[model samples]
Target: MANTSGNAYGLTALCPIINGHTNDSNPLYKAAGESHDKEVRRILQALPLNQESPFANTDNTYLARLFILNDVFFQQGNDFKRDQLKSKYLCFNSNFHGELEPYLTSLWNNNENQVREIWQHCVAFESVSNANDFVRYIKSCQLTTTLFFNGSNDQPVAEQLKALYVKQMFSEFVLTQQGKSAAELKQAFKYFLQRVQLNDVKSPSWKPGQTEVAL
Candidate 1:
């Protein structure tokens, strides 16, 4: 119940980053002075954005992000003791539809290479060889989502995408069909319904992470 609010799942994980330099033999580690955490950040920054993002291919993923956690901030003039993290961490948070296991499986299956590259610097991540392994690894690093915000109404991503597609197509139809004859308007309306495919959520629907209108 901690990570679930209806059908939506909010996942948060803090995978401990290794406190070591990148292996010299690795092609990605061109600089001998680069740390594991720095290389992870560089790769994250180079990831494709918007429609081309890795999460775009990940099924049911509404949103996902990754970043390195270097340290906790100090509250100035506070009397409480300061917190010092034992190691830098890789922070991953994702909002998605369906169960955690399924979503994690989709994530690993779709972006295995990217996942391996980013999480290789994290502790115990080398053991993650498949979807099940990835799920277990994530759970080990998972933190309870105490206060998840349900901004997506717990709807499956396919349904939401279809809704967006229908709305866009209908709006365009309304604008373009102005001043048509009654018979012509009726014909156009039939075509609009066919094109929108109100019952079919797969075809002619908005692509996940789409940023522009294609229809």
Candidate 2:
């Protein structure tokens, strides 16, 4: 942490960089700051956030990497893959998209657009600075990940499977928009299905009575 800043002013030395409330020490902030300088900013840019904190810590970069990994991983599996021409990433990118839609909508509806924009600017994660491009990244993914679970009459599994088809279409749309032919979509489908088969392999198969049965 900042080369210990000498024996007398140890922690007091780092007040200019990190929030003293969180770090509270010289060696901690120093070491963290050095690591952050190298990794966090670049990863945040790759995640393509609006702005990167010059002094973000290792924790922030680690999380950004996880997001990128999840993006690629999701593109690989079958059932695990998203359904739609778009994905969870895109739809969620919408300024106000989320599970708490009703509440957000209630606010959005009753308020004037000007007031709504102000509130959005002042409150909520989406409203705040596009920290690390968080909202855009999520919206890009969400365009396709909707469950669309009918919840009407079919069993849960049926509805869930219904979503897979949509996710497949989503991949195709992405592939197409990027200039891949329709045939390439078929290829990606095959690639992901193979991954799904591999994931299936991780679980033991069923036996008449000696197996873990799911309901």
Candidate 3:
């Protein structure tokens, strides 16, 4: 499947938004007359970005985004007939490492409330009551990926983050320890290794979606 290129998976889903306005009294929506598409977009926009993104909690998620597609674009210089969608769709695209099941499971497990809030406006999402249901619903909405671009090595996210941490720390060590005595340099290198704990990928490493290094 095009969705699987090595250990990476690209997920593309277009879930139809409900045709009517939400009747729920949630403050996130304008109960009087807000369209479902508008509510979905509002929820997505209010979501935290970067390290605080819901995907940041989802294991192995390299990238993900969401948007509302109200209609199709007309191309070919207006010679060809323009097409229009019957309904608006909540478009979701994700690029991640490892199998789709586990990745989606992690997403549902880690960000269930956010997922429910955003996807509730989409048709049939009410059937998603748990992780398995969420996975199944997403699969039903999934489109076959015709082409998936793999830009990085197919390594587990933890390993990749650890490698980056090692590189940065080693570079800093090289710069700061310059011109030290041989013994001092050797001792400093040992401390650096101990601090980095290169054998452990879980700690002293970059967090997923982290933008700025913590002081």
Candidate 4:
């Protein structure tokens, strides 16, 4: 738990990690406080990169902010953050609490049943319609490859069906108001390509000669 004094906006400044703060805004009489503040500033200067927030006033606030920070870093496109969140996306059973890295890696590599099961169970994801169509298109490719999924996934299949409906809906239901932007469609296509390139999890449809060519 770190302590924070009021900063410029009086937001209990948590960032730019520091101990005691400054502005020349306040006049102080104690030389000891000044010395302590200088030492704190020195420590902060020395540990810029790895510094923690000094205004995580409560335990819950600290945890909440930490989670947000993790999300920010993840979304910033950092390789480490991408890997970390991808681990969260591809691995990690939210219901079962335990050591995640090994269990998830094992499940991803060795257990398609579990991986598909976990994947199918996700309900909170943004259902990107164009991407979903592209995924189904790839899945429909008759290359000797197959991504085995749980047979019990009727709902998941329905969801895929709905995504198909969504892709078509833009044209049919929306009366040609306009479809997804070209950039959005390209991003969807790129995402599908990336999925097809899973290293240890070779997808059959991904192999050459299995799918149709678009001229």
Candidate 5:
């Protein structure tokens, strides 16, 4: 795979072709740790090409973050640290235990497609001008809602849901009270907390915050 050098972006200009072998006694392919790391790095670097930017493409960013998190999880020698990292990063079975290049490529492509779907279905995302707005848009979108509930529990959908809620709250404070000081922001947050009740439905009960806050 490393026979050809990568471009300036650390991505290969041409994907290497692996010929199928008909031999029954051929040894199974095993990826070296170093090779896996290199492939992960390459994929992360190329992720931006799949979209305008990481911030504009949450699904792609999500996949890139997963690769980084999984890499960190693998590098730790301590068992306890590894376990902790695993709990946080390795939520879903991505079927990444096989070949390195193909698996990483598949992940990047799949995320790219998912981001496209999100953009197509979620019109609110187009009007997002800031991080907070982006979060609110994602929270209000049905695509994210479906993914949050029907999607795999092992995935980072739960983390995404939490992030959306937090961003939505922060954005609400900023949008409604434009000239508020830090003290005012804090007070608003406290007031919001007192009035907001997280019921069994997990939905917040404010004007705009009353959207479906799923996990």
Candidate 6:
């Protein structure tokens, strides 16, 4: 089984910058320096898409793992340790990469160009407005794949992806609102939860699991 616990630091660092969440004083922004484009390329290289096309075989586990990793990276403090992060990534690869290979090979065998556009969008997601936009994109891709491939198993897959997205978004939102008083933060978080619940009502598939979003 693939280990889905590892975080995607590359996306976490890049997305906030792209969405204007980070500033010059931020360590992540400083790390990118003047060559932000180069840094993006380097990060993409570090976390490449599956060897095969993303649209063909239809296993979203790898994609989900990427989002999970990105969330972890986003939540890291200014005192982030490169050595520790590297060790975690190594463990993630060892545990999950092998398991994901067979599915990727099947996807590649089925179509070389399938889902290429979505893959490009994912890698070049800096233009995305925020975490919500990013999550919606993933949900859309999962839904599109389901419709195109006529797969019944993908609904749950898409839900899982949305759940992860929400979890990360909430975490990031809370981080940004650090100035809020405890009561204010709590109220804001409750309101956010209500919004998420309403969204889920509109589209049940987007509903996260009970424990997915914590206070």
Off by over 4 Å in 6: 1-156, 198-215
* Per-residue lDDT over 20-56 for candidate 4, one digit per residue giving the tens place of the 0 to 100 score: 3333334662433543234333433442121132211
List lDDT for all candidates, in order.
0.90, 0.29, 0.90, 0.28, 0.35, 0.38
Q: Compose the digit string of candidate 3's lDDT tens values, residues 63-86.
A: 899999999988878479989898
Cα deviation of 17 in candidate 3 (Å)?
0.7
Structural similarity to truth (TM-score) of each candidate: 0.93, 0.17, 0.93, 0.15, 0.21, 0.25
| Candidate 4 error regions (>4 Å) | 1-10, 13-34, 50-215
lDDT (10s digit) by residue, model 5, range 94-158: 21122334433443354445433223222233464444443343334212111222222323333
1-215: candidate 2 lDDT, tens digit per residue? 22111111111000011112222256765666543222322333444232232111111111112211112233666557454422111111111112322322333333334222222211122432333333332333332322222212322222333344435545564665576678986797686565444334222222211222231
Q: Alpha-carbon error at 78 in model 1, in Å?
A: 5.3
Task: Give Cα distance to truth, residue 103, candidate 1, Å.
Answer: 0.8
**Error at 207, model 2, angstroms:** 41
Q: Write the per-residue lDDT of candidate 6 for residues 109-154, one digit (tens) a residue.
A: 4443432322332344444444344444333333111112222233
> Which residue pairs show collisions in model 5?
91-154, 92-154
**Arranged by lDDT, best first:** 3, 1, 6, 5, 2, 4
Give the higher-TM-score candidate: 2 or 4: 2
Error of 3 at 19 (Å): 1.1
lDDT of model 2 at residue 70?
Answer: 14
